[model samples]
Structures are given as structure tokens and as C-alpha cells.
Target: MALPLVLFDVNGTLSDMGRMTQHVEEIGAPPQLAGLWFATVLRDGFALTAAGENPAFRAVAEGALRVVLAGQVLNRDVDDAVAHILTAMQQLPVHPDVADGIRGLTAAGFELAALTNGAATTASGLLERAGVRDAFAAVLSVEDGPGWKPAAGAYTHALAALGRGADDVVLVAAHPWDIDGASRAGLRTAWLNRDASPYPSAMVPPDHEVAQLGDLLSALRT
Candidate 1:
């Protein structure tokens, strides 16, 4: 049998997004406030896309950061702070389990790839730094498609790139929305439930769930 293709989400699935909030806190900003800024970035990114605008993910993220920092009425200038934050983001560290889990999956004969809403540069840089870029057969971004995901086409394009259909692929992600979107596109779903959070009731149940990526490969043993 051809091993099931493994498609991963880049951000929360592979990397630790909470670190960005903690990074801002290290600079004397409140962690919750930093989270708010990060949330705004996601909101704006989707809005721009739905509006038929093609703002780069980095630019949308920076704009959201500007608005977030300015909202507090602090003396700090938003533009400079945004620049610092962007650079800091590029340097954000990955979770310790990421590299090993990826290696395990590869060793298990899974054809690996990534499908991310993030810019290709940002996603590749993170994986390269984590020393697992070589494990993936492909790394794709939504920029080449109509928009970022929650749109079925994002997952559709990703599966197409792998030259596989829904039955041959499994979409793994930490986000419920991403899982829902992938499922809607007819791919088997795996929820990397790192947070132990409950799944959303409105969505279809995933084919698999695991608290850690290390457990994921083991669970998928054929």
C-alpha cells in the first residue's frame, strides 16, 4: 500500500505561537495584550482576502500590530514596535517535539508536506531553522491560491499538489477551523490537540487526535 500522505499546518501545528505573546511580555508588554495583537493580525488577514485584496501576510500582521500598539496610547511608536515585533517573530523558537515527530513520521514511510496560510518564506525559514525542512516533500502557501484557508480550495490545492485525493491524505493541525476546512475538502483529519481543548461541536469529528506529534506517528501505525 502507498503510505497515507501527511499534510501539516505550519503555525500552531508545528510551531509554538504562544511564544510570540511571551516575547512581547519579555519586552515589558503584557502577554494578554500581545495575544490581542496577534489575534488582530489573523482577523485582518482574512478580511483583506475576503475583500479581494492581496496584502502579504507579513504586511497584514504588521498592520494589526500597529493598530494594537496604538490602541494602548503608550508612548511607543507603532511603526518601530511593529518592525521589532516582525523581526522577533522570525526568531521565535519552535516546540521541542517538532523535529523528532517529523522525523518519526518520515521514517514511518509517510509522504510528508506542509500547507500553510503563512508566507512561504516564513514557513520555510521556521522549518529550516528547526532542521526539518528536508523531511517535507513540499511546502505550499495560500498565496498561490485564491486565499488563505477555511476556504476549501486551500486544502484542495494542497492535496492536488501532492497528486493525491482525499482518501490518500490526512490533514493534521492544532486549529479546529483548519481541521474543519480540511475535512470539508474531503481529506481525512488529524487533530494535534496540544492544548487538551475540546473540539468544536459544529464541526465534523476528526479521524484521529493526539496530544503530541510523537504520539501521532505511533497512532498512525498501519
Candidate 2:
């Protein structure tokens, strides 16, 4: 059998978005709101997807940040705060385990690609900075897809772009929604449960679960 292509979700899956909290503090907003702001961005983005609208990631992120920063006392204006946070996202470093994990998967002869809701350039820059950009066959963005993920069209777009069948791909992500969406789209899924949080009851269970990205090698071998 041919090895299944590994489709990685780039944000929280490969990159360490938690560092945004530090940027939030540096910009004079409550650090904790960084998480809330990101969550709100996803919430609204998903809502837009469900409504048949596709908003750019940066647009949604900046709008959500403004809402989150409203009424908060910041050293800079709200626009500056939003710009600082978005800039921080663009410069995010990949998680420590990601490079080795990606390298291992590539060494094992499985094709790899990055499927992100954000700009493809962001994903490319992140992997390049981590020294693993060459491992990916492609860096994809929802901007080029039919819609953001969890929408069937997005997964279909990726499979078509890769010239592979859904059954020949595995979607790896840290988010339950991403896993659930891929499962529903007829692809295998591996959930990177770095936080050990319980899976959402409403989502489909992942085929594999690991606390770290490197653990996926062992998980897939079995």
C-alpha cells in the first residue's frame, strides 16, 4: 500500500501560537485576552464559513482583536494593538517538536503538506525558519481553497491539489474541530493533544492521539 500523505495544520499544530500572550502583554492588553481573541477569531471565522462566506484570516483576526481590545487600556491605539498582535502571529516560531516530527515523517517516505487557514506564506516562512520547509511537498492556504477547514470543500480542495484520494491522506491537527472535519471528509486523523484536554464529545474521535508531535511516528507505525 502507498504511504498516506500527512496533511499538517499549521497554526497551533505546528507553530507555537501561545507566544502571542507575551506580545499582548507587551502591547499593554491583558495577556489572558490573547487566547480569547484567537478563540473569537476562530468562532467568527467558522460562523462565516457556515454562512457561505470566506473572510481572509488577517481580516478576521484583526476584527476579533479590536473587539477583544475594546475598552482595554493599552499603551497604543486599538489599531496599533491589533497590528502588534497580527505581526506577532506572522513571526511565530514553530513548536520545538515540529521540525523533528516532520523530518521523521519525511524520512519514513510519507508525503507531507501543510494545510493552513492563514496565508500560505506564513506556513512557508514558519517551516523554513524551523529548517523543515523542504520536507513539505506543498504549503496550502484556505485562501486558495473553497473555504476554511471543517468545510468539506476545503479538504476536497487540498486533496485535489495534491492529486490524492481522501483515503490516502491523514490530517494532523491540535484542534478537535480540524480532526472532526477531516474525519467527516473521509480522511484519517491524528490529534496532537499537547494539553491533555478531553476530546469534545460532539466531535469524531481521532484515529490516533499523541501528547507531542514526535509521538506521531510511533502512532502511525502501529
Candidate 3:
């Protein structure tokens, strides 16, 4: 059989979100609040998509951060902190396990690609900075399909770019919603359960579950 293509989610699945949190803390804002605000950006972005609107993820992140900052007393250089966060998103540090596992998977001959909620250029840049850009046959974004994730079309866009059928692709993500969305779009899914939660009753269980990308090699090999 032809090896199945493996697609990965970029943001939380591969990048360490600590950069955003640390940047805000240095600017005298609560670290957790910064993380919460960053998360709210994604929530609101997805909500807009669900409501038939499409907004840039960067815009949403900045808008949400500003709202959270409006209620707080910030004394340090706030704009610089926000800039750092945005740049961090563009040059995300890979999760410690990502680089090795991706290299291993590539060496094993599986075609690889990245599917992200960020813009196309942003995804390409981040993957380059993380030193794994060469492993991906393609880097895709929800922007390519004119909508955000869980929309079916987003995964469709990615699979189309890779010249692969949905069933021959395995979408890997840390978020349950991402996995569910990819599955709904007809791709096989592997849940990278960094947090190890049980699946909800209605959400389909992933084809395979692994705590880290390193574990994925053996699972996929089978």
C-alpha cells in the first residue's frame, strides 16, 4: 500500500505557547491572563467563521489582547510586548518532540504537510524557523479555503494541495476539535493527546492516540 500522508496542526500542536505567556508577564500583565486572551482570540476567530465571517487570526489575537489589556494596569512597554507575541507566532519554537519526530517520519518515507489556522505565509515562515519546513510536502492554511477550521473545506483545501485522497491522509492535532473537524472532512486522524483527555461521547475517537509525535512513528508504521 502507498504510505498514508500525514498532516499536522501547527499552533498548539507543534509550537510552545509559552512565548506568548512570557512576553505578557514581562510587560507586567498576569501571565495566565495573556494565555487566556490568546486563547480567546482563537475562540472568537472560530466563532466568526461559524457565523459566516472570515477574519485574520492575527487581527483577532491583537483585538482580544487589547480588550484584555484595557481592563488591566499595564506599566511596561505594552506595544513591544504585543509585537513580541505576534513575532513569536511567526517564529514559533517547536514543541521539544516535534523536530526529531518529524525528521524520523520523513526518513520513514511518509509524505508530510502542515495545516494551520494561520495565514499561508505565516505557516511557511513558522515551519522554516522551527527547522522542519523541508519535511512538509505542503504548508496549508484555513485562509486558503476562505474559512476557519472545522469547516470541512479547510481540510479539503489541504488534502487537495497534497494530491491525496482524504482516507489516505492522517490529520494529527492536539485539539479534539481539530481532530473532529479533520475526521468530518474524511481524513483519518491521530490525536496527539498532550493532555490525555478521554473523548466525548459524540466525538469520534481518533484512529490512533499518542502522547507525543515520537510515538506516532510506530503507530503509523502499523
Candidate 4:
């Protein structure tokens, strides 16, 4: 069989969002708000996509931050707090397994690409900082598509960019919704269960599941 192009989901799958907890605390909000704030962004983005609107990730994230920060004690004003978080989002580092995993895949003759609901620049920046930007064949965003991912159009856009069909790609994501959507869209799916969380019974299950990114090549080989 021909090698499948590995499509990666950016946000939590590639970037280490947990690092943002300190940034949130720096703004005088409770550290737990970091997770809640990101959940809000994904919730709003998914809601907007379901409503047939293509929302910008950063815009939705900023709005979600405002909502999350409202009525909270802050070291900075709301606007500044929002700005701080947004900047931190762009500067998020990649998971420890990313660089080695990506290099392993590349060395094994697999094509790789990034598909993000966020900006291409942000994804590109993350990969670049990890010293693996050139390892990707493409870095795409749902902004170029009809809507955010979990919506079929988003995956379609990525497949089209790679000039490949659904079966020729594998979507790897930490989010179950993303894995389910990609599976439904006819692409192979891999769920990166970084924290060892149980897969939700409600979603379409991934074709492969691994505890870390570095395990993916081995999983696929098996």
C-alpha cells in the first residue's frame, strides 16, 4: 500500500496548551480557568460551525476569554487580560514527543501536514519553533474552508490541498470530535490520548489510538 499522508490537528494535539495555565495565572485569574477558557473557545467554534458560520479561531478565543474573565479578579484590565492570553496562544510550545515523532515519520517516508481551526501562521509558528516546520508538506486552517473542523468541509479542504483522497490520509488529533469527524469523512483516524483518558463511547471511534505522538508510526505499522 502507498504511504498515507499524516494530517495532524494543531491546538492541543500538537501544541502544549497546558503551558498556558501559567499565563492565565499571570493575569490574576485562577489557573483552572486556562482549561475552561480553551474549552469555551472550542465550544463557540463548534457551535458557530454547526450554525453554518465559519468563525475565526482567534476571534472566538478572544470572545471566550472575555466571557471567562468577566467578574473574575484580575491583575490587568479585561482588554489587557485578553491580549495577554491571545499572545500566549501564539507562543505555545509543542509536546515533547512532537519533534522526534515527526522526524521519525518523515524518515520513514511519510508525508505530513497540519490542519488547524486556528491560523496557518500559528500552526506554522508552532512547528517552526519545534524545529520541524519544513517537515510539513502543508499547514492549513479551516479559515480557508467552509467551516471549522468536525464539519466535513474543513477536512475536504485539507484533502484537496494535498491532492489526495480521504483514504489516502490519516487524521491525528487529541480531540474526540475531530477523530469522529475525520472518520465520518472517510479518512483514517488516530486519537492521540496524551493524558490516557478513556475514549468517549458516544463518538465514532478512531482506527488507531496511542498514548503519545511517537507511538503513532508504530501503531500504523502494526
Candidate 5:
């Protein structure tokens, strides 16, 4: 049987956002603020979606950055700091295993695509820089969908675009909320547990769990 199409989550799952800490520190902000800023964006995005609004990722991210940086004494102008962090986001490198894993999965006959809460251009740019952009059949964002992920509409939009039912696609993400959302939307899920963290008990557990992206080639085969 042909393998299911592999749907990837771009941020955190593929891109190495850990590099953002350095960029954040460059503007005199605490390195830890990098993580907090991202979390804030997600929190605000999710809140907007729950209230029946489809929020733009960049807008939310920029707003969150400004709020997070407000109390910090930055060496540079605040607008410049925001611009710096946003540019850094566009240029994030893929994780070490992404290129090899994506190639392996493609060579094995599994079609691949990307879905992100952020911009499709960012996801495509990251993969393009990693020399693997051609491997993905499509790079999508919530902008193309009804709402942010964890909302069924986002996965549903992806399914419609793929012209496949939920059963024929598998979502691979590092976030439990994303995996749970995809599962609830009727797609199979794989949790990319790069940090060896325990799966959260409150969410729907993923169908598969791998320590890294390349492991999916073996995990799915079995």
C-alpha cells in the first residue's frame, strides 16, 4: 500500500527556533524572552481563534514582541528590535535532521507538505535554504485556512487542499496541542519528541512518537 501523505508542522517541528535567543539578546533583551515571545504569540492567536477571529501570524507575533520587550532596556530602537527578530524568523534554519529525513521520506514514496500557523513564505524559505523546498508538494499557512491550528478548520483546510481524507494524511509536529488537534480532526499524528519530553496526559496521544524527523521513515514503516 502507498504510504499516507506526510503533513509537517514548520515552526519548532522543522525550524530551529533556539537560534532566536541569540537574536533576542542582540537587542539587549533577556535570552529567555525569545521563548516567552513565541508562547505569547500562540496564546494570543489561540485566543483570537476561539473568539471567532482568524488572526494574522505576523501581526500577533509583532504585537507580542512589542509587549514582551516593553519593560526591557534595549540598546537599539524598539521598532528596530522588532524588525530584527521578525527578519530572523524568516531566515531560521531547519533542524539538523530535516533535510535528510525529508529526502528519505520522499525517496520512500511518501509525499510531503508543510502546514504552519505562520506565513507560508517563511516555511518555504526555511526549506528552500535547507535545500529541500522541492520535496514539499505544498507549503500552507492558517491564512489559507479558516483559523489557527487546534481549530479543526485548519486541518480541514489542509485536507481539502490535498484532496484527501483525514485517513490518508499524517500530521507530524513537536507540539502536543498540534498533534491533539490533528487527531481530533481525524488525521493520524506523530509527535516529534526531539527533547525526550513526556507526552502530556491531557491531550490525545499521537499515533507515533519519534526522537527525530528521520526516525519517521522507520516508525511509519512498522
Candidate 6:
């Protein structure tokens, strides 16, 4: 039987966001603000989506960064600091398990693709930098979709773009919200629970759960 197409979430799931803290410090902001700044970015994005609008991820992120860094004692101009951090985000490296996990899945004959709330170019750059760009059939961004993940239309848009049915695609993500969204859209979900945290009770449960990406090879095969 042909293996299902696996759609992966790029940011926190595949690429590590820990590098953001380093970028934050490099720009003279408190390293601790990195997490909060990211959270604010997501919050604004979701707000825009909820209001029936889809804004570009870079715009939202840059705006959020400016607000987050406004009161900070930055070594450079606030705009320069924001630009530096945003540049760092674009060049982030994939997680340690990503290379092996992607190779294993490809060897198993499963097609791979990436779907991100950020720009597709960023996703492509990330996989390319990690030497796994060719492994994906496509790298999609929410900018091309109806809205971001946690919205059913976003997954449906991706399925349509990939020329696959919802049942033929499986969404692999670290966020329960992404899992829930894919599940509601009639796609299978695999939660990459690297942190071993409890799944959110408010969302649908994932069909498969693994502590790391490498474990997905076994999870999908079975």
C-alpha cells in the first residue's frame, strides 16, 4: 500500500525556536522576552484570523517585535533590533531529530510536505539549510491558505493544493491545536510531544503520539 502524505508543521515542531532567545539577547532585549514576544505574535495572528482576516506572518511578527522591544534598552534602533531578530528567525536550523526522521519517513515511501503559518520561503529556507528541502513535495504557508492552523479551512486548502484527500494526508505537529484542527478537517494527526506535556483536554486527541520525531517512523509504519 502507498504510504500517506505527511504534512509537518515547520516552526516549533521541526525547527527549534530556542534560537530566538539568542537573537533576542543579541539585539539587547532580555532573553526571557523571546517567549513572550512569540506568544504575542501568535495572539495577534489568531486575532486577525478570528476577525475573518489573514495577515502576513512577517508583518505581524515584526509589529509584535517592535511593541515587545519598545521599552527595552536596545543597543540599536528599535526597528533595527526587530529586523535583526526577524532575520534570525528566517535562518533558524531544524531540530536535532528532523534530519533522521525525515529521511526515515522518505525511505519508508511516505511523501512529505511542510505547512507553516509563516511564509513558505522561510520554510523552504529552513529545510534547505538543514539539507532536507528536496524531501518535501511542497512547502506551504498560511498566507496562501484561508487562514492559519486551528482553522479547518487552512488544512483543507493544503489538501487541495497537494492534490490529496483529507484522509490520505496526516498532519504531524507538536501543538494540540494543530492536531485538533487537522482532525476536525478529516485528516489523521500525530502529535510530536517532545516535552511530555499533557494533551489539551479541550481539543481532539491525536491518532498517534510520540516523544520525538524519530519515533514517528515506527508510529506511521504500524
For candidate 2, lDDT tens digit of each residue in 96-189? 8888888888888989999999999988999999999999999999998878999999999999999999999999999999999999999999
Model 3 error, position 85 (Å):
2.4
Q: Tell me how far candidate 1 lies from the true structure as C-alpha RMSD in angstroms.
A: 1.8
| Model with the higher TM-score, candidate 3 or 5 | 5
1 or 2, which is superior by TM-score?
Answer: 2
lDDT of 6: 0.91
Worst 10 residues of 1 by lDDT: 71-80
**Runs in model 5 lying further than 4 Å from the true structure:** none
- Ten residues in a row with the worst lDDT in model 4? 76-85
RMSD, each candidate, Å? Answer: 1.8, 0.8, 1.7, 0.6, 0.7, 1.1
* Cα-based lDDT at residue 126, candidate 5: 92
Off by over 4 Å in 3: 198-202
lDDT of 4 by residue, 194-221 (tens): 9989888999999999999899999989
For candidate 1, the lDDT comes to 0.82
- Minimum summed lDDT over a 10-residue window in model 6 is located at 144-153
Please give the CA lDDT of all the candidate structures: 0.82, 0.92, 0.84, 0.94, 0.94, 0.91
The TM-scores, one per candidate, come to: 0.92, 0.98, 0.93, 0.99, 0.98, 0.96
Better of 1 and 4 by lDDT: 4
For candidate 1, report its TM-score: 0.92
Provide the lDDT at 32 for model 2: 98
lDDT of 2: 0.92
> 1-222 in candidate 1: lDDT tens per residue?
777899999887887888888667645566787778767877887777677765677888877877777645443565656677788888766787899999999888888999888888888999999999999999999888877886777777777778999888999998888888888889888999987999999988788999999988877773
lDDT score of residue 150 within candidate 6 = 73
lDDT of 5 at 46: 97
